[model samples]
Target: MGLLVKGKWYDKWDYNNDEGEFIREESQFRNWITKDGSAGPTGEAGFKAEPGRYHLYVSLACPWASRALIMRSLKGLEDMISISVVNTLMGENGWTFEEEEGVIQDPVIHADYLYQIYTHVEPEYSGRVTVPVLYDLKQNKIVNNESADIMRMLNSAFDEVGANDKDFLPENKMTEIDEINEKVYGTINNGVYKAGFATTQEVYEKEVTTLFDALDDIEERLEHSRYLVGDEITEADWRLFTTLIRFDSAYHGHFKCNIKRIVDYKNLWRYTRELYNEPGVKETVNFDHIKKHYYRSHKQINPNGIVPKGPELDFSLDK
Candidate 1:
């Protein structure tokens, strides 16, 4: 709900005055860890891919962090890289490591707040401390916090360290992957936030209608094909799947993006169940964390902080 100013934390949530929409901050660290120790976007060299050299800081409630978790689990990098989950409900500062179920307390530095970790790397760091932070153990700094870049890094960089062989972003399909990622991010991934945090009725209507319109397009696309990109499951599918899986549970009601639930969409519903059934993917999702965080954290949206109990999701049972 807040950000750091010159390494000082503040508690201010005034993005939306009339509407309760949400606006995401830009990620700070843009560096990458390539296979040949090459520099990416930003940062110095010598970030060679090695086993047990990196750790991921994430929050289960965050879709951006969830994307990295999916890639980490699918790539079989559990042993290579460690992870710490911050509490879902962002408090005065932002993501925290409060002792809770499925939440990993800060291990390396024993810090309570996530911004502390950011300041540890750069004392004067001025930005929002977001999740899916790829920390470099050797350098004692953050390698990358951008989820899209992290997804690509996890997909390819750690092969020498025995990470999973599955390539979510195959070279031949990079063009298509990029195309789908843009649409999904604009309409679905960030669309709900635009709706929930919209400052005006016109803005909310525009975003919500766009959100459902994008969903309808995806639903129709999935009706014929098994995945978004051809029959093979690509990075695009997994990235979109996390948002769809969370739509009915959180965005539909919490974000006021209730045009229609993914459950109401025939193709999207089945496709969501299918993705949830993926071996490592399902384990990363914690509905309790997701529900409690959104409902309790955003006091502006739900003043009572009371979470609903119905709309049970049986992703495990069957289609």
Candidate 2:
């Protein structure tokens, strides 16, 4: 994972602490897009939700970025917002706009690397150059880089601006959704990383165990409710879906989250299939990019960088 240091590129993959635990970098840009150009829950104002004024940058390989992609598709914002797809392999230069199959060129400013977008916004910026960036062409600044925030904004902000009025995060279930999001995020969403990137065996074992425990809990819960919160699909389900969708393909073997394949759990297997069958939702998944990035990008994990070819995943397998 290369990062920008004071606006400069540094090719590094270190994410461990003294305790040998993986530490994910926090998102830097926090601005939000709202209907009235007002400040969001935790961001500044003026990033209005308007058609043809915003652009999205994402990597199909990234789960966080895929969250925003899924929300965009679910809300029917494809025509309202534009997007650029980065190359699957993130090398020394970080996320690049390299011309490749399934890769869309960066139309805004025609920058080569994703970091250029960040540096252009703030020349002296310092942080990881991540994707699923919401750019405001009018202001020429990043609206937000946090996937959760972007997902929520896409769900509601653009409704008045021609986006479909489907709210995954309903007001009545906000409290319950937030609570589930917290648990799922820590133990399942980020847990695979903690286990895969752990510098010590102790950390890996502890994280892997906790991850399976959480999966077991989710498996139990899915037996009762079709969705995470209730019978109706919500943002919580979408949030966890990104991670689960990639569990068998990337996290299971590549990230060492092999305690159980999602297919082994009857309820989770069925739920994943149900979500994948959602109209417009399946279009967002790119298994080719997902496998290549995890196996090729992380040199420290797989020094030879050999992408795997087995364990064929059929989302419709057990449904």
TM-score of each: 0.96, 0.98
Residue-by-residue lDDT tens digits, candidate 1, 151-189: 988898998779868988888998999999999999999
The global C-alpha lDDT for each of the candidates, from Candidate 1 onward, is 0.87, 0.92
**Top lDDT: which candidate number?**
2
lDDT of 2 at 256: 92
Q: lDDT of candidate 2?
A: 0.92
**Clash number for every model?**
7, 0
Off by over 4 Å in 2: none
lDDT of 2 by residue, 1-319 (tens): 6898899999887678899999988898899889998898987889888899999999999999999999999999999889999999999999998988899998888999999999999999998899889999898999899999999889999999899888898899999999999999999999989999887889999999999999999999998998999999999999999999998999998989998999899999999989998999889999989998899988888889998886776787444
Least lDDT summed over 10 consecutive residues: which range in candidate 1?
14-23
Give me the displacement of residue 135 in model 2, in angstroms. Answer: 0.5
